[model samples]
Target: MPATIPFKRSEMKRLAEFAKREGVRAEIEVNGFVFRVAPDFNPVRVAVTEESDLDHALAEFDRKHGYS
Candidate 1:
């Protein structure tokens, strides 16, 4: 089994508000584990590539595995 951590809706709202107000990171520690909380400043966007890139990647995979 895996360990899980849960937060109440009110706690999540308060944390978000605190982060927004302070404009800094907020951290929480539980059972000796520490976590840093912050809003995603620059979320990664999926890149769109040409179809040739996919063909090349598939060819490379096939070559590496000797797939005929």
Candidate 2:
């Protein structure tokens, strides 16, 4: 099941600014219609811990996905 959140139009600006700064997507529903605000283009970053097994797994994934 999905959660139903109550939204107010007064918070649009704050939400937009937050989304832009954090590079996230925000959705708003009004009158049964949905509107989305997406941040500017930003590349995704992957973080790996300093572990041999995790490093090997990430390398294997990159090789399998042609990202190496």
Candidate 3:
């Protein structure tokens, strides 16, 4: 069995415009000491806070699975 996924150009454009208006430009800031890191699209940066959070989550997941 298969399902069809429709791609609407107009819808995409509208969504992009909306994102731009909402300041949805791809960006990340990873300053270890800074709390206000702007987002990046080209060669985006990953904020330290985000990385730390993800690291903690992964550690917890691994621990649950008895991963050393």
Better model by lDDT, 1 or 3? 1
Give the root-mean-square deviation of each candidate in angstroms. 7.2, 10.7, 16.6
lDDT of 2: 0.77
Which ranges in model 3 have alpha carbons more than 4 Å from their true place?
1-41
lDDT of 2 by residue, 3-63 (tens): 5545665677778888899989998886686767888885765655546668898999999
lDDT of 3 by residue, 1-68 (tens): 75333434565566566666676653322333212222334776999999999999999999999999
Q: Estimate each model's TM-score.
A: 0.43, 0.40, 0.39
Q: Which candidate, 1 or 3, would have the higher TM-score against the true structure? A: 1
lDDT of 1: 0.75
Model 3, 45: alpha-carbon shift in Å?
0.3
- The backbone clash count of each candidate, in order, is 0, 0, 8
Question: Could you tell me how far off, in angstroms, the CA of residue 10 lies in candidate 3 after the best superposition?
Answer: 36
